[model samples]
Target: MDTLMPADDLTDELRAISAVVATLEHAQQNELPDEFAGLFRHDAIWTTGGGRRLLGRDAISAFTHQVLPGAMAASTATYEVEHVVFIRPDVVAVKVRQTPVGRDGVPLPGVNPGSPTYVMAKEDGRWLLVAAQNTEVVDG
Candidate 1:
């Protein structure tokens, strides 16, 4: 079956989504777990790159607080929106590319980058991540 695209301004929507994704990266770079978790919905779901599932915002906060502070101790990660598909006027699926860089600002070796999918929903004129899955890009 063919999916019908919404009639909203695609460019504007893309820009808005990109900004949200950027904030996720910024939060990680700064090691601010609360800021990172705040981007999600109250009942958001997330799967980590290590395959652990987080059920809600509170769970996400707990996990992030335990891990995020030390995550970038050796290297920082950057996230960029690679694609955005609007499933509806209020829902979007976003593909993001994440790369970890060393203190010298060089891409780290032996550590593969990640590709994460974020499903976002627009509510009360704001976009919030409703669900997300982060996967490590393994090179064979």
Candidate 2:
């Protein structure tokens, strides 16, 4: 178990992590594969909601470029930071909630939200995603 930072420091770290997550959502919404990949570390690893594993920024970029254009053909997605846990002064785990919405901004029916966990690491005073895993919520 890792101890947390001070309140103020934690808040600042959370905010920084949120910014990274915001950029991710923006890139996805706009279908900008390069912009999306730019948020990750060079050796970052990502597991898609559909369980595809992407190793490194280049692999992630390739996968995004191939799938993102058609991904939002019928809907858009909004991502929100749900929680943040600092495992170390320079590392944090962020949980995000992702909802898919129609063009009218209303959530689409029968589509459960996505839960994504992003592990971020601070490098050269900037936070970059080191690893991420996205999972779809399924009702049993």
Candidate 3:
């Protein structure tokens, strides 16, 4: 690590993380199950907003394939990285804000926003989603 902790390095890492989130948005927007599923680690754990638990990449892939297609035909979701906490040089906790919007670029009413946190780990020079928990933000 550079003595400065390299502001440039931090920026680069954030950029890469942002790119990953963008890829996730693209995959979901296009309903590409394979592309969406490929972002996770082999042993990744994911819990859906509806509270369904998915263990491992295979399970996640199956769920995506089953639900992703035709899921976006009605509306599209955009994910924004709201905050990132660096757990270590190679690990991070990412908070994403997900909103559903229509073709006209307006948010769909009655659809609660998503507050998901993705635990990402860098391995073999690549960042992968190691664990994720998706929670929908609903009004009390």
Candidate 2: which stretches are off by over 4 Å? 1-4
TM-score of each: 0.90, 0.92, 0.94
Can you list the residue pairs that collide in candidate 2?
Answer: none
Ranking of all predicted structures according to TM-score, beginning with the best and ending with the worst: 3, 2, 1
- The local lDDT score (0 to 100) that residue 60 gets in candidate 1 is 97
Model 3 lDDT on a 0 to 1 scale: 0.90
What would the per-residue lDDT of candidate 3 be over residues 39-66, giving only the tens digit for each residue?
9999999999889999999999999999
For model 1, residues 64-115, the per-residue Cα lDDT tens digits are 9999987887789888888777788789999998988886678888889999
Off by over 4 Å in 1: 1-8
Cα-lDDT of candidate 2: 0.88
**Candidate 3 runs further than 4 Å off:** 1-4
Worst 10-residue lDDT window, candidate 3 = 1-10
Report how far residue 77 has shifted in candidate 1, in Å: 1.0
The per-residue C-alpha lDDT of model 3 at residue 2 equals 38
